[model samples]
Target: MDHLTFKLGRPVTRTTSQFIVYPAESPDAVRHAVRLGLASPEIADGLLSPGRIRLSLTATLVAQAAPGRPQVVALELPRPGVGLDLRQGSAAPAHVLSRFFGPPPWTERYRQAWAEIANLLRAGDVTDTSVVVLTAGEPDRAAAVAEGLILGSYAFDRYLGYRRKPSTERCVRLAGSVEAGEMRQLARRAITVAESVNFARDLVNTPAKDLGPQELEDAAAELARDLGLKCRSMTPAQLRKRGLEGIAAVGQGSPRSPRLIVLEYAPARPRYRIALVGKGVTFDSGGLSLKDGKGMEVMKKDMAGAAACLGALRAAAMMELPVQLTVFIPAAENMPDGTAQRPGDIIRCGSKTIEVTNTDAEGRLILADALVLAQEQGHDAIVDVATLTGEAGRTFGNVLSPVLGNDWTWVERLLSAGLTAHERFWPLPLLAEYREPMLGEIADLKNASQMGGYTAGSILAGAFLAEFSPKTPWVHLDIANTSWSAADLGYLRKGATGVGVRVLVQLLRDLAAESVGSEARRRPRPRAATHA
Candidate 1:
């Protein structure tokens, strides 16, 4: 697939093929467009009628421009009816505009506006044209235009015969404070992240029969080796030797066995060490507690968490971020067989024993050993990602995953990083109140919190993993819903969403940047992406 490239250049006047992207965030923004020559003052006045405004994306304004005049492609804000409350140009009108256009969370509507811009370009099949993005002041908001374009350009039709690559590789020229070189750099970064996301997407979309623990480990090893990161993998016996019984237990049913794969990128004298553990259930059949056929169909994507970690580590290494990182993937295919773990079976996970009450909840079991291993390594902080529960999906849907942890500050920072990266999360309270249901009568903990009335299955899963590392500044990301989608949404294909990779990569970048800032720093230079 041909990747879209954005080139930054000094702004200039143009005609014919030229397209203008104007943000109609507020009435004042519309007027500002006039002041910037993006629109006529009369056009700004016309916006007051509401009828003149296009409610979604850049729509062509015919007879709106004279011969030789640049085409005005106005981007309409989502939910256009509510934003124009006469208080638009008040003292602190930015508060109104921001509130209206930039909701505190995922301003997905705003992104949709941007996505629609791509939709316009793609629809027209306009190729090799320069798109001049117009905005007044707000450079951050301006940058989001580039973000949405790249996002909207994402496609994963490689398996299909008639698959066509995203059309129109336009030159994206930003008419703002962001330098062309900077915009080029941001595009490169976004592309690298997107490519990794697509990499995870490919991994999760592959059939589990062809992508067992060994294949998953081989992929990680190849990525680590090519990216200059250290790679190591443990066989089922090695896992048993290391006392990772919980990970080994669920895989006993499958002939493929399990693997404990570790990839490390240790830069010299790195300021902080970050450890990430991902649940890599290549395919899940729910073991002895088999899931119904409907529930088992999409089990191949269960390894999305592991794919995400691999993608994040590869991106960080590819970007040469100055942070030491370690990623653990407890990979296996959970199936029901004669030797499969039973409902009442017990397995040793790190220092504690967990009773398997529901084999369908096998994600947490593998993650248990991986989390303990990460915490034991003395990393500065640890975070685990898993598609561990259906309740999480039921509660949050495919929008924001649930984040829980003991360290509120770290959770807040990670979630904020997710927000900034456009991979949002909603914080679920990790109250002590949630832990009561996790206790196991026969063992230290139970893999399944099937106790009646405890409908917070996602939270209880987090609570169960919490038993591994009690005091580490750890964060838990339950990506049960966000990992895959039945319908495509901006940059996300219908299958694996490559959910956590961007957020985790963003977190590492932010940490690396934060460290550099504290020491009289400079933004790390971008490097060429590593090839297979």
Candidate 2:
């Protein structure tokens, strides 16, 4: 893990650096550029009007070698991407930022962009402690730019033999009266979140041999203990006694049997209580319905949902959000052996019998039992996150996560939280029309659609889990596409994305706020003096 540090210092007029970054707010307003002594007004204007500056209708970034500033190189700062419209007309702040910020408003996008900038500066022989991130406009937004750099430069290379020492120690100086304390706190929280996200990615990146069901349980228990939260894991005997047959069926193929991990965050009189269930298939080989060698290569990440839920739990514990959270992870490995579950096998999940039509559709089976357990435990809402379907990826690409649920309000709340956290989501229907396709001839339901697995797979998976949810509001997040990056996307590198940590953290915070506001409204206010 590459740990990042930040320092806050007063702004200065004339600073010397091998590289200087300038935000191009307006081409006509060259006062700041003139003040920085980059060039004379006429010269700067002439140099900036070239094809590089005027090529794009969207904001532009122009970097050039400064003529008289010795070794100094200047880069023009602009919004991240070109012509992105996330607001299909919604006036949400996150959407507004997404539309205008050039970058897709995802923190990782900003992080990735800034990381690249730092690499460029380092590659250009600017091996100093810090780079000057000078910006235009309100100047306060410089903190955001600073955060991007801090988070984007993160890397996980412990398993690799080589380590590259990074230059640029701390001071991310910008021209503003930004509160040093607030800036530090921002960086600190960003570091915490970044570390947690990276931790999740690490778990996902680890091979199944090292991170099996038992190993993942141990990791979760360690995180819980360190975070000062309560942790407990149900052994195979316990799961079997409680009739968690779906879980048993999935893990029986492996010598390392299934375990149900439960972690609790109970603050002093928590304002709200919520349940979270994450799918944890440590290594999925699709059981008897085996996948090809290429398909099974990345199966270690089938547990990303579980990793994300654990990461979110860690964040909530650190932030001490005024909410009680119960996290349930159904950990298992789907392997092919004599003991492995086969297609058409009947497995009992809670009170319902599920006919395993396709052993590949095993995630929802374990999730069903966990969700039922969450409901029995009592909570205001229940949410399950999973990398459950490839069809979802084919539909939305890797840009947006898909959400399906029974409650409109909870679904909408999750979507809103996603936008606010910059982990955007889109809603999919759990339509009654498709619910019928999940029925099994011999059992209460089928693990998969008998017709085929391709059509509306994600939503059908949600429908299957819905059978086990409590009367409380429940939401299902399908992050199949958003769980990994093929290449570096700003803040995120080419590995596990740790996609759900921030979104769930934000959701808990919102629930805490709602709880506080509701309490305040109920409190007795002073009866106005109505003396006639």
Best-matching candidate per lDDT: 1
lDDT string, candidate 1, 1-532, tens digits: 1123442110001111222233344332232232222232222333545444322121122112111222223322333342222212111111111123544443455455666555545444433432334443444445456555555545544455665543334543334333444444554676567567767877888888789999999999888878877899877787777777987898999999898999999987776788999889999988888889999899998998998998898788888888899999999889889988888988888778888888888888888888888888877778898888888889987778998776666787788899778888988766666666777898988777744665788878877887786646688899989999898676564778888998998888878877444642332221111010
User: What is the per-residue lDDT of model 2 for residues 323-396, given as tens digits with 9 covering 90 to 100?
Assistant: 89999999999999988888878988778888888999989988987988898886878889998998788889
Question: What C-alpha lDDT does candidate 1 achieve relative to the native structure?
Answer: 0.67
lDDT of each: 0.67, 0.66
Candidate 1 Cα errors over 4 Å, as ranges: 1-110, 119-124, 129-137, 141-143, 162-177, 431-433, 515-532
Q: Which stretches of candidate 2 lie over 4 Å from their true place?
A: 1-109, 118-128, 134-143, 162-175, 450-454, 515-532
| Superposition error at 178 for model 1 (Å) | 3.3
